[model samples]
Structures are given as structure tokens and as C-alpha cells.
Target: MITTKLYNRYQTVIPSEIRKKISVDPDSIVEWTINEKGKVELEFRKRLTEKDIIGLIKQELPYNSVEIKKRSGRGLDWE
Candidate 1:
């Protein structure tokens, strides 16, 4: 098992081995939880970006920004 020392501010750096194994990065979100058996769990998740949701919405046709503006009555010059 990997071990790390808690510093004065009650903070500990996750070990490199564990970080690499979990693919943790600077932008990763850490979730801490305690199971019913009192075992601490750490979940690492990457922060979602626009690129991640690009294809989340199913579309029958390619997105057209101009068409969207026209439908919204904002005109092609919409800022």
C-alpha cells in the first residue's frame, strides 16, 4: 500500500504511483467518501470541458451557427 504523511495543514500529497494509476491530473476533481464499513474511498474524476460534451446531444444534421441565429431572430450579425 502507498503511504504519505499529512502535513501541518492536514494536507497530504497523493503518491505518484497512485496518481498515475488513477490518471489524476491538476484539473481532476477529488471525491472523498466513507463506506458503511468505515473504509475511506477516493474517487478521481477529470473536470468536464466543452470538448467532452460536444457529441452528448444527438443531432440529425450538422450544427449551423448561422441557422441558429436566424431561427432565434438575432440576425447573422449577432454578437
Candidate 2:
């Protein structure tokens, strides 16, 4: 298990290997919560925005252009 000490009020470096295993980035906003036993933990990151989703899709499927599925009952409305 990795042991980390909290120092200075606003500066802490989560170990690089841990960050890589968790796929966390520098600008991520972390959420901390305490369990019933008073042990604090960081929750999973937030949901991705539409742009984030698109970016991930492109990263995974670089050769493919995504096709949008329009809502049902939409009748030829192109503006």
C-alpha cells in the first residue's frame, strides 16, 4: 500500500504511478468523502461532457467519422 502525507494546505502530489493506474490528469477535480468509519476516500471522476465524449471516441476510433442518430419522429428538419 502506498502511504502519502498531506503537507502544505494547498499543495500535495499524488504519486505518479498511482495517478497513471487511475488515469487521472492534472486538472481533474477530485471529490473526497468519508465513510461511516471516518476513512476518507476519493470518488470516481465526474461524467464527461459532450466534447469529452467526442474526443474519446476519436482517440479510440481515429479512422471513423461518427454518424449522429437523430431523434425518432424527426421529419427531415435540416437547418
10 residues in a row with least lDDT, candidate 2: 64-73
Clashes of each: 0, 0
lDDT of 2 by residue, 1-79 (tens): 8867878796677888888888888667789999999999886575554345544543443332233223222443433
Residue 2's lDDT within candidate 1 is 75
Clashing pairs for predicted structure model 2, backbone only: none
Residue 46 lDDT (model 1) = 92
> TM-scores, in order shown?
0.65, 0.52
Model 1 accuracy (lDDT, Cα): 0.78
* Candidate with the greatest TM-score versus the true structure: 1
Considering only N, C-alpha and C atoms within 3 Å, which residue pairs clash in candidate 1?
A: none
Please give, for residues 1-79, the per-residue lDDT of candidate 1 as tens digits.
7789999999999889888888899999999999999999988889886457566789897686556546555433534
Candidate that would win on lDDT: 1
lDDT scores for all predictions? 0.78, 0.63
